[model samples]
Target: MKWWLIIILSLSIAFLGCEKTDKPTINEDGTKDNGKLESGGKNPKSKTGVWLTDWNDAMKTADVLNRPVFVDFTGSDWCIWCQKLEEEVFGKGEFLEYAKKNLVLLKVDFPRDIEQSEELQKFNEQKMKEYEIEGFPTIVLVNSKGEEIARTGYRPGGAKEYVKHLQELLQPKE
Candidate 1:
C-alpha cells in the first residue's frame, strides 16, 4: 500500500514537471492568444502580413499565392542576433511591405525561455535537421514546390538593404 502511494506521487511529480509553464495558445487565425505578436510583440498587423508558425499552412498559402516561402529559423527569446534581425529588418515597415507583396513568411522558433507546444517543438526540430540549420537566425527561401532556393543569416543595415539583399539572392541566375 505504501509502495503504491509512492508510485502515484512520483508519477504526479514527473507529469507536473514536464508540463509547460508558458505555452502560448494559438488561435485558429494563427494569432497568439497571449496578447503578443508572433515575433515577440514587436509589430501588430503590418502591410506585409503575419508571420505563420505552421509549416504546412505556409506551404499551402505559398502554393495558392504563387509566392516563395521565407522560413526564419530563430531563437526568439534567447539569441541576441535573432533579436537584432527581428528588430532591424523583420520589425521594420519597409520589410513588412515587401514581404506582404512578395513572400509567404514562416517562423520556426527554438526558444530557450518561451514554452512551445510539443507539436511545434517537434516540427521545429525536424526542420532544423532537414535544413541542416546550425545557428540561430537562419533564413531559408523555398519555392512553392518546397524546394530550397536560398539561405542567409543576420546582416548589417536596416530593412531596405536587407530587402535588396533578399531580392538579389532571389533573382534568377543568367
Candidate 2:
C-alpha cells in the first residue's frame, strides 16, 4: 500500500509540475512574462483580435486561414475609451487568452494625436471606408468570406462572458 501511495503521489506531483499550456508567467520583477508574444503581446491569444497596420495584409492573411476576421477599430493614442479597453479588457489575462483562440484579430488604429506612418494612415483610412466605421473602438466580426457578421463596442464582462459573446457572434444569424 505504501508503494502504491508513493507512485500516486509521484504522478500527482509530475502532473502539477507541468507548465500550463499558455499561461503567462509572473516575473520576479512584478511583470508578466509575455514570452515571444504571438500577437504583439498586447492582446492575449484567447482574445483573437490584434492590431494591424495594413488592411490589405490582414485580408491576405485572413484569406489563407479561412477564418473570420474580427477587427478592433481604435484611436490608440487619443481615445479614452480605447485606453480603457486596453487597460480593463485586453490587459486582463483572462480576456486576452479568450481572444487568441476564437477569432482572427485585426486592429485598425487611427491615432489623431500621435504620428502614424503615412502608409499606415492610408491603410486605416481605406479600411475605415471599406468597413464604414462610425466611431472609436468598434469591434466588427466578419465571416470567413469577408462578410460582416456582427459589431459591438467594449462592455463590462469577464473572460468567460467575452468568450460567450464571441461564440455567439460566430453562430449563424437566424
Instruction: Give TM-scores for every candidate, taking all chains together and pairing residue i with residue i.
Output: 0.72, 0.64
Task: Show the lowest summed lDDT stretch of 10 residues, model 1.
Answer: 39-48
Candidate 1 residue lDDT tens string, 128-169: 999999999999999877799999999999999999999999
Model 1 RMSD, rounded to 1 decimal: 12.3
Per-residue lDDT of 1-174 in model 2, one digit per residue for the tens?
Answer: 999999999999899977477676775445575663444434233223555555655555565445667788999888888787777777776766665445577778888778888988887798788989999889888765667889887776754566677778778767
Scored by TM-score, the top model is: 1
Off by over 4 Å in 2: 1-50
